[model samples]
Target chain A: EDQVTQSPEALRLQEGESSSLNCSYTVSGLRGLFWYRQDPGKGPEFLFTLYSAGEEKEKERLKATLTKKESFLHITAPKPEDSATYLCAVSRGGRSNDYKLSFGAGTTVTVRA
Target chain B: GAGVSQSPRYKVAKRGQDVALRCDPISGHVSLFWYQQALGQGPEFLTYFQNEAQLDKSGLPSDRFFAERPEGSVSTLKIQRTQQEDSAVYLCASSFATGGNTIYFGEGSWLTVV
Candidate 1:
């Protein structure tokens, strides 16, 4: 079975403070790893997708890096508007399971002003 | 629409009732998905569709959960005999291509079963 676990269930960071959120996973075959931002009462907004070890992707103040068994979402100088729950999900490449995204419990981030 | 759109942003149902949620994916999107997000938890995949075909529904919790994308554009997820455990935000997402493409999500339909 594919499983994902995220660390720091809740985080509080002051404005301009940088931090990193961790996502650990165990999968049969890693097809893709995705990052998403979700606000209260809203669906997840796609952020980044990392496909291979050592692969990295960046968008504005957010950067995502992937390893063999884990992925990290690094936030740089986050602002209050960046406060939201961050989620990590994975897809299986092998044929055993269908195309379903297995998601982590998520890390709730709050950026203080 | 520019992004995936869902109807009934909020819903309240009593036990044993049935509810239907609608989803309109992005124009020309080839794939659609349904997910359930419980409070303080990440969204969990419920089902998938490739065009009009229901490909994978392994994640559905029970037989009462039914989903369909008849025309390859709009989809509906119907839950029968709702239970308190069924309360969650049902999210709908769509992608232009298959698994590798980015999946855009709607605001989601918050369902509360009493």
Candidate 2:
């Protein structure tokens, strides 16, 4: 079965603190890995998509790196506005549909001023 | 719509009552998806539609859950005989193409079954 797991269910950091969130997955054939940020009462917003192992993408203060079995979302100088639930998802290729994403239980982050 | 939109942002239903949730995808989006999200948990896929055709309903928990996208633009998810276990947020998402990976989501509809 394909599964995705995120470590450190929650994290607290002061403004300007940098940290990384881990997401590990087990899939039949890796196709793509995605990162999203969700705020309360709203749907998730896309951050980045990594297609292959050793691939990386960056946006603003966030960076996403992918490997065969895991992905990391690194935040640099995070601010309170950046506090939100970070989610990681993966898609399986080959005979399986690549459009459907299996997501991990998100890691909630709280950045204090 | 500028983005995906779900109607009835909040709903309270009796245990045996039926409820219908609606989703309007972004204009010209070819793919639509439905997901159920429990509090503190990630969203779980419920169904998928490409245009007006229902492609996958494997993620639906039971037969009582039905979804349809008759016109390939707007969709509805109907739950028959709601149960306490059905209490969660129903999310709707759409993407530019049926086979593309990127999807955009709407603010979910919160359902409370009592």
Candidate 3:
């Protein structure tokens, strides 16, 4: 069965501290890997999309890299406002009609100022 | 609206009662989806709609769960005889016609079955 797993169910980081979140997947025909940031009571906001191994993308303070079996989201000196649940999702590689995402239980990061 | 929108941000239903959640996708978006998210867990796919056609409903938990996107626009997810286990945030998402496109999510409707 296809599976997506994220490590460190919860992370507490001091302001300006850095950390990494992991998302491992065992799915066939990996089409895309996605990263999202979600705040309490709000839906997830798009962060990055990596299509293949060794691909990387960066935002203001977050960087996401993908490999064949897993993906990592690195936070660089995160701030209190950066604290939120980071989610990783993957979609099967197939026809254009197959667009559903399989997600892992997200990692909740709390950055204290 | 500028983004995907959902109605009845919160709902509380008695067990055995029915509830309906509404979703208005971004204007002109070709694909719409519904997901259920339990507390402390990630969103799980429930169904997908490509225009007015219901393309995928396999992820739906049970036959009591029904979704529709008639007229190729606004959509609704209806749960019959709500159960306590049905309590979760129902999320609606939309994307372009092509595959691998970024799927945008709405604020989500929080349903609590008592």
RMSD of each: 1.2, 1.0, 1.0
RMSD from true fold, candidate 1: 1.2
DockQ (Cα-based) per candidate?
0.70, 0.67, 0.82
Please write out the lDDT profile of model 2 over residues B1-114, one tens digit for every residue. Answer: 899999999999999999999999999899899999999999899998989999889999999999999988999999999999999999999998733368889999999998
Against the true structure, candidate 1 reaches a TM-score of: 0.97
Error of 1 at A17 (Å): 1.4
| lDDT to native, each model | 0.92, 0.91, 0.94
Residue lDDT tens for model 1, A7-107: 98999999999999999999888989999999987899999989899999999999999999999999999999999999999988865453678899999
- lDDT at position B74, candidate 2: 95
Worst 10 residues of 3 chain B by lDDT: B95-104
Which residue pairs overlap in candidate 3's backbone?
A: none
Model 2 chain A worst lDDT window (10 residues): A90-99
- What are the per-residue Cα lDDT tens digits for candidate 3 across B6-106? 98999999999999999999999999999999999999999999999998998999999999998999999999999999999999999987468999999
* Model 3: reference contacts kept, as a fraction: 0.76
